[model samples]
Target: MVERDRLIAALEDATHASSIHNSQPWRFRLVEGGVAVHLDPTVTPRTVDPVGRWALASIGAVVANLELALTSRTGRAVVTEITLGDSIPEAADLAGGAAYGEGPLAVITLGEAAETTTAMTAARLHGAIKERHTTRGPLLGGPPTEEEWAELQAAVAWAPGIQATPASEPLVRSLLSLTARAEDARQEDEDYLEEIQNWVENEAPSGTGIPRGAIGAPDAEGHVPIRDFTQTPMGSSGDGEAVFFEDPPALLVLHAASDTPVDQLRAGYAMQRAMLEATALGLGIGVLGQALEEPDSRAAVDGAAEESFGAPVVVHQILRLGHPAGTITYAATPRRPVTDLILD
Candidate 1:
């Protein structure tokens, strides 16, 4: 039987994984063999993620953390089983065997921990869980070395049905432009604005949502625009004075073979692996989901993906990678305590 303390510790590590706006829309339950991850619809951003794509991805990230944590703790291989409910039920069920209500996003089973090269690699990535934070501040330093880039690519390649493509300079510019347009459109929508405002908190008692202090100062005009989580003016006014990127940082487009709930979950797993690998290599990473979250904008990116990869694929997320600019620090986003997240 899995030690109760170790299982709880792994669950805590799972909470540290990334989520949209730090919403952390997930719950966990201790099952017979391992843990079951469920989507907490109460915290899901319905306006932005009506289809639960981001929610599934978020759960996938949690699974990635759990696997790494359990493997490291017991020195065993972790196996994951995914179940898709009918029509992708909105809330977790949490009755009897179906811990997630309708159907679970994933049920991860732990194997006996063993001493192996793979386990050692997972241990290293597991160590990066706390160190890995989604960077919104300006990323500084040189681009990743070719070898480092290859490693990141390999990390994604390890997962089936997911592909990563490095964006060219022109494509990157197009993506930025598309993202800016999407952000502008979202800002104009009253419901979208209201929903976003509801999720951004200067100081959240629940320890979810984007913190004001974590908001980056606005960039000067002509630089890539980041989503303004603060709603209020937070970053530097683009006076066209400060220089941002000497060389464009690495931009990667993550795509799934098909656009299904299971595909999205797998994509999320691959994404977290890539991010953790990047963190282990001393690289900073940020995600731009504005375009992907918008229907028209997402279609544009899908077209781009088709052209870039010579096959039609669903673009799930965009990752910005580079070294950080000088010494950078920000308050960590708050997460719900394990007591609140555990169902049993």
Candidate 2:
């Protein structure tokens, strides 16, 4: 069994994993195997994540952090289980043991390490946990090198059922179009606008929402379709003048074998692993979640993924990577304390 203090420490770091709208919709409890992660539906956004896709991804990020931390500490870990239910009869039949319910999404079992051989990569990624912030600011210093992109691909390789591919110029253009269309559609919905307004904390960081400083300045050229979070009045532009985002935006799409609950969580884990790898390489990262939020655009994103990867895979998330334009500092987004997140 894992030590109590170690588990607590790991949980503390795991909270830093990215969540949609900064809504940390995850809960953890100590189990016989290791730790059982549950979905906290109370904080899940009803407007954006209608079916808990992104919510499960958020939990997947948490699982990534936990695995990295525990493996680094003990040099051994087996992610035993993750249950994101599939209610669709055929899908449920295909995804064995994926029962839909209030059960835990994943259980990470740990073991002692006699020597530190397998944990080298784990330790490296674990070190990047605190450094992984959602960077919406324009990333410069030119596009990441091929070596850097290769490092990210290696990270994705560890995640079974998930694949990451750099988008082509045409595909990037298509995805950007989908994002812009989705953003425009989102802004029109009163419920969606209200969700943005409610989650954006203008003055200071709260226990849950994002601060004004963290939301990056808009893209001056209007090339990147960054989500505008400063919409208290509904459709209000982000604060500060816009700047030019990196040209030929380096976009990576995380895809899965099928659009099932199991695949969604696995892709989420891969998403965090890739983020941590990018962070380790000193790369700024941003998510184009809007592209996969709307139904039509999401299907289009799926099609684009199949075209890029040369396989049948569903689009789970799109990430933007680049070097920061300058010394960019983001206001810290708050994470629920381990005490608050841990179940009794």
- Most lDDT-accurate candidate: 2
For model 2 the TM-score comes to 0.91
Best by TM-score: 2
Candidate 2: deviation at residue 144, Å?
A: 1.8
Q: What is the TM-score of each predicted model, taking all chains together?
A: 0.89, 0.91
Relative to the true structure, how large is the alpha-carbon lDDT of every model? 0.76, 0.79
Per-candidate total of colliding backbone pairs: 16, 1
Model 2 lDDT tens row, 26-110:
7888988688888776666667776667777888888998888877766675565676554433443121122233678788887
Q: Residue by residue across 247-338, what tens digits does model 1's lDDT show?
A: 45568888876777677777888899999999999888878788887678899988876776687888988898888767668677788898
